[model samples]
Target chain A: MSENLPFLVIAAPLFGALVASLVGWARPRYCYAIAMVSLAAGLTAAIALLVKVSGTVSGYEYRLGGWPPPIGIQHWVDPLSALILVVITAVAFLAVMSARANLQLELPGKERFVYPLMLLMVTGLSGMTLTGDAFNLYVLLEITSLSSYALVAIGRGRAAASCLNYIIMGTIGASFYLLGVGYLYLKTGSLNMIDLRQIMIAGDMHGSQTVITGFILITVGFWIKMGLYPLHGWLPNAYSFAPHAASNLMAPLMTKVSVYVSLRMMLSVFTPDFLAVHALWAQTALLVATIAIIAGSLIAYSQTDVKKLLCYLVVAEVGYMAGGMWLMNRAGITGTIYHIAADAFMTCCLFLGASGLIASTGSRHIRSFRGATRRMPWTFAAFLVGGLSMIGVPPTCGFFSKWFLIQGAIEGGAWHFVAALIFSSLINALIFFRIIELAYFKDVEHEDDVSHPPQVQRNEAPWGIRIPLFITSVVIVLLGVFSPRVINWIERFVDSVGVT
Target chain B: MSDVLTFIISRFNYWIYIVLMMIGLYAMIAKRNYVKKFIGMSIFQTAIILFYVSTGVKSGATIPILEHGHDIGHAAAAINPDHYANPLPHVLMLTAIVVGVATLGVALAVVQKVHDQYETIEEPEILFKLGQE
Candidate 1:
């Protein structure tokens, strides 16, 4: 079971997706059960893998069909990869479980197709996280992109157009990534990331024009996919317009997966030594990350729609991760890794809560949230917890990630990043607090009745929606309490790589 | 001057690739029609295939298939036996081609959806209507 864990973790969801797609034709309602069961199994395997790999000197590398590295496709499950796999599968499990009711409401007749496509998207994401071959990453990236396009367009009317823009931008990003791989293959003779790392170190090709070109192309491609600043034009509308369940799942996972890809490439594929030896590459990364952080926060502050605001905040959160990676220290890289999970949970909580709000009142505008707390106290309290996490307040997962980042900045003597992180946190707090105040304090006059209604009402979101939101909120708090242990695990893993 | 010219000619495939890639990129950025932009994207992706294939070409090379009389020891040796072109790039390009086609299919579906909603594929007109909404 342990030997087959890597394949099982990825293959379970993929096999389930295929079965669901085919079997769903006979009984549509069964698709939800199939997807949830598959994801639950995958989640169990991932957690097992994480425990098995924790505090180990070496990582697990499983080659397909018994072929060796550079020839056969391999799945590398280092501590970092194991951690990300857990995050992806865990969030996906919760999202699919919560999505059943929302899918019935939003997708209605199309619920069958939604379940299979959602499962397929999970398969693609897990494949991307688990694979070590560059070309395999591209294939998995496409699978995810194709399913996401379909999922986004599942909404009526304007969602189709937004999905179209997302496809276009996403295609460009993937193409650029392919081109970079092409350049890399031309220069060095391998596509396995570990082999490529060895070749890069053995040869003095760090500052060569070809290697630099490949680096730029790959970085730009990932930047676009991660929705960094100027390339983030497609995110806000796409998230805002997609059906509630789709937004909830995608808003938390997609860009974070892309960020993980970028970090893997920078640290594992291109090694810190390569970046350190190349002045232009390091400076360019630092510059772009700074710009993305500032720009994403400012734009997020200006959004009026709840989902759109969260979408822009995703953009800013990507910047924080990207900035930490560019810092290129143990503290910075560990923060980026921890933030991936922290941000995933925090974003999940917020989106799930927002979905509940949307279910209660079919409106997504921030102004429509006036007096929601009185009507939906549990959901609102969950939202408040999510908002505090987003603001990086103490006793939440978000704060510890920021703490590591600020400490990394200080160690690097880069006060500019420290300032940018502080500014972004301030803006996040202001924006979310404004919504909290509206939901709690504002009065709503009932026009349907002769008298003013009481501050509290009997209305609350359904149990299905509230359960997931509550679970994620509790996870965020637990993650905060256990931050030191998690950070230690990540640091040990980073040190084992022997890079820093 | 002669060395520079030699270098340019040696990398002629990359130069043509660059030219084709630039054309595709310009059209993707400048065109308003969605289908046309998608076509441009396909062209851009295909150009990389050409660039990659070109890079694998040796000055005087045969195909990378194993032959009985070739006396190559293993698959790696067969890759460039008698100065044959590298097969790694070819294998990678195969995957890229499939991804390109998948992207095109999704793009076409999205275009169909856009047509259904706006009743037009023109960017400016769609923007105007969306603004009005």
Candidate 2:
């Protein structure tokens, strides 16, 4: 049973999707309950798997259908994958906790399809995290992308247009990934990641032009999927226009998982030795990451819509993780892995709270947050916690990730990356402070509030939204307090992978 | 010049696939019509499928299926190393084809919705209307 946890984590959602789509047509109301139950089951399996993996020097691999590697596909849940699997399921659960409210207001009668699509998307995401086969990863990536395309299309007012753009960009990205895998297959005749790694090392294929081209193609594919910098044209509109419930889950998981895939490609499939052989590639990637950070931060600073602002912030967070991963040092890998977990939760909490505020304030503009602290104090507080985390304040998970990232840059002598991190943090501080001021103060044009007694309205978001937001905020702080333990786990994984 | 001709002729499949891919990419990027863009996407995906399928081809290889059917030991002893073309790429591309179709379906549906809402499927027109709204 313990060995089967990897398959079970994915199976729970796949089974739920089947059941929901089947029964939901007749009884649409039960779809939400089914989705919740399945996600909860997945979360449970993921946590158990994490616990099991944490006790081991190396993690377990469950061969599918009792078949061996290079031929049979397997579920490889190393400590790294197990940790990320837990984050994916946990974030999905939290995001779905508030879906009941969001969907009722937004779609009204479309719970059945939405729930199943969300479940399938989760299935694909978790499957992508768990699979050891490169081809299997591509299939699962399509499953995720296809379902998300539909989910994004479910949004109101210009969503379909954005969803079309997303589909076009996403298809190109996924196709490039397939082409890369095909190139590798032509070279090695094996689709399994571990087998591919072994074969490449044995065959001395690192310097081979085909293998190098495959690596670059694969990296660019994931960069597009992850919306890194110039290739991120499809992201902001697609995410901001999607339904809140969908965006909350997609925004955090999609890019982070893509980052994880690239990292997995580097550590597991391609090896650090290969990365060293191509030092120029890593330097170029880091430079692009630096530009991504500066550009994403500046664009985020310019957004008037709160949702769009968060979306741009997500773009910048991807830069942070991408830069950290490319730093090619132990501290950098640790920071990247830790930031994966931290940013997922931070983005989840922020998006959840922002959706709640948008619902309550009846506007998407930043100015709609005026006097929000008096109206929905709990939601504002939760959002503020997320904002501070974004700014990398101490005692939040964000700060620890940034600390490791900067330490890595200093160690690697990449002063530009360190400067970019500091610059992005300062910009984040400015963005959040501006919002905080708007939320805490009355409008400046109507400055009669200083002399008169202000009436504080207690119009808070429902418990559905507040509870998840509160839970995520608490998790952010707890993760921060327990950073050393998480960092230890990450460092162990990095060391085991021979990154240093 | 003869050597370059031999090189191009020997890898003509790859060259054709690259050409098709570039054409598809151009249409996807430059075309204003949604349907044309999607057609380009299909062609782009088909080019990749062609590439993958082409990789499975061997000069004198037959189909991957064994002539001995169920006699594994006998077949293993009798079969030559290069007797069969690889079947995995075709199998993988079957999945890719299904994914391509599903993506096309979703893309078309979104285009229909866009047409319904804005009464146009042209990119610039949609942008102009969205800007107005």
Considering every candidate listed, which one attains the maximal lDDT?
A: 2
lDDT tens digits, residue span B49-96, model 1: 898888777878888765675565554543535577878788778978
- iRMS per model, in Å, is 1.2, 0.6
Error of 2 at A243 (Å): 0.7
lDDT of 2 by residue, A399-494 (tens): 999999999999998899999999999999999999998988774245575877466667788788889999999999999999999998888889
Over B1-133, each residue of candidate 2 has an lDDT whose tens digit, in order, gives 9999999999999999999999999999999999999999999999999999998889999999876668686557677758888888899889999999998988999999999999999999999999999
Instruction: Compute each candidate's TM-score over C-alphas.
Output: 0.96, 0.99
**Pairs of residues at least 3 apart in sequence or in different chains that clash in candidate 1:** none
Give one digit per residue, the lDDT tens place, for model 1 in A1-500: 78889999988899898888888889888888899889999999999999888746667899988889999999998988898999999889877777877876787878777888888899899888989999889889999988988899889868988887788788889889988987887788888999988898889778778888998899999989988888989888888888887888898899999999998898889888788877666566666777888888998899888888888888889888888888878888888899999999999998898888888877878887788777888888988888999899989999999999988878877687888899999999899889878886774565355366665565677788889888899999999999999998788777876556
Query: What TM-score results for chain B in every one of the models?
Result: 0.86, 0.94
| C-alpha lDDT score of every prediction, in listed order | 0.86, 0.92
Estimate how well candidate 2 is docked, as a DockQ score.
0.94
Report the C-alpha displacement of residue B60, candidate 2, in angstroms: 2.2
The 10-residue segment of model 1 chain A with minimum total lDDT is: A443-452
